[model samples]
Target: MSKHTILGETAIQQLLLDLPDWKVIENKITAEFVFRTFADAIKFINNVATVAEEMNHHPEFCSSYNKVRFSYCTHDVGDKITDSDLKIAKQISELARNLNGKSGY
Candidate 1:
């Protein structure tokens, strides 16, 4: 399938199996990462930015004190989930794991 093609429910479910911390919510695959401190959270976000820039696939995120929630979807494809989104989500999850970011707030 094309990278930008919208994923169906079955495909999305299969993809999410490897991403235990992520879930489908309102058409987006999302996860929340909690860091020990606000600075750490910011650091994770910055790292994510670099990776996203390299991939040219940015995620929607919100950071609070020590928690950051990241959501991924292909807005150009009707805000639907796609392979590109899953790829970025995997990278983001790996980054969070490397930075000691806990999977939920």
Candidate 2:
């Protein structure tokens, strides 16, 4: 087993409450927001990807025109969720919010 296995739904729920802008989705947390244009959304994802890549984490993302949805969970640890997942989730939420002056999520 891995550290991610230690987290349960209740713990995840509390973390989600504290994180306001992110939502827990089973083992993944998702955040979504719409941008001024498709180009803007793509730029935003690229920026987010840079931070995620640096952290050795990545998001499962989808884009439709100006809308973007991102899901994050650590993949190395049996695709299980962990504090690392929540940390990155919060960090991504903060960075994206700061960039646009809104949570966008």
Candidate 3:
């Protein structure tokens, strides 16, 4: 399937099985990562930025203190989940794990 193709419910659910921290909400795959320190959270965000840039797939995110919530969707495909979104979610999850960012608020 094309990377930009919108994923169906079953496909999304199956993909998410490997991404335990991520959940499909309102058509987007989202996860909140909490770090021990605000600086750590910022570091994770910076790493995410670099990866997102390299992949040319940006995520919608918000950070507060030591927590960062990321939401991923393919806007070009009408804000629906796609392969690109799942790929980035995986990358982000890996980045968080490497940086000691705990999943969830």
| Top-lDDT structure, candidate number | 3
Displacement of residue 21 (Cα, Å) in model 2 is 2.1
Give a tens-digit lDDT track for model 1, residues 10-65: 99999999988899999899999999999999999999999999988898999889
Tens-digit lDDT track for model 3 on 1-105? 455878899999999999999998888899999999999999999999999999989989999999999999898778889999988899899999998888893
TM-scores, in order shown? Answer: 0.93, 0.80, 0.94
What ranges in model 2 sit over 4 Å off? 1-6, 101-105
Model 3 vs truth, CA RMSD: 1.6
Error of model 1, residue 79, in angstroms: 0.9
What ranking of all candidate models by TM-score puts the best one first?
Answer: 3, 1, 2
RMSD of 2: 2.5
Off by over 4 Å in 3: 1-3
Name the 10 consecutive residues with the lowest summed lDDT in model 2.
96-105
User: lDDT score, residue 19, model 1?
Assistant: 89
Residue 68, candidate 1: alpha-carbon lDDT: 98
Task: For model 1, give the 10-residue run with minimal summed lDDT.
Answer: 1-10
Candidates ranked, most accurate by lDDT first? 3, 1, 2
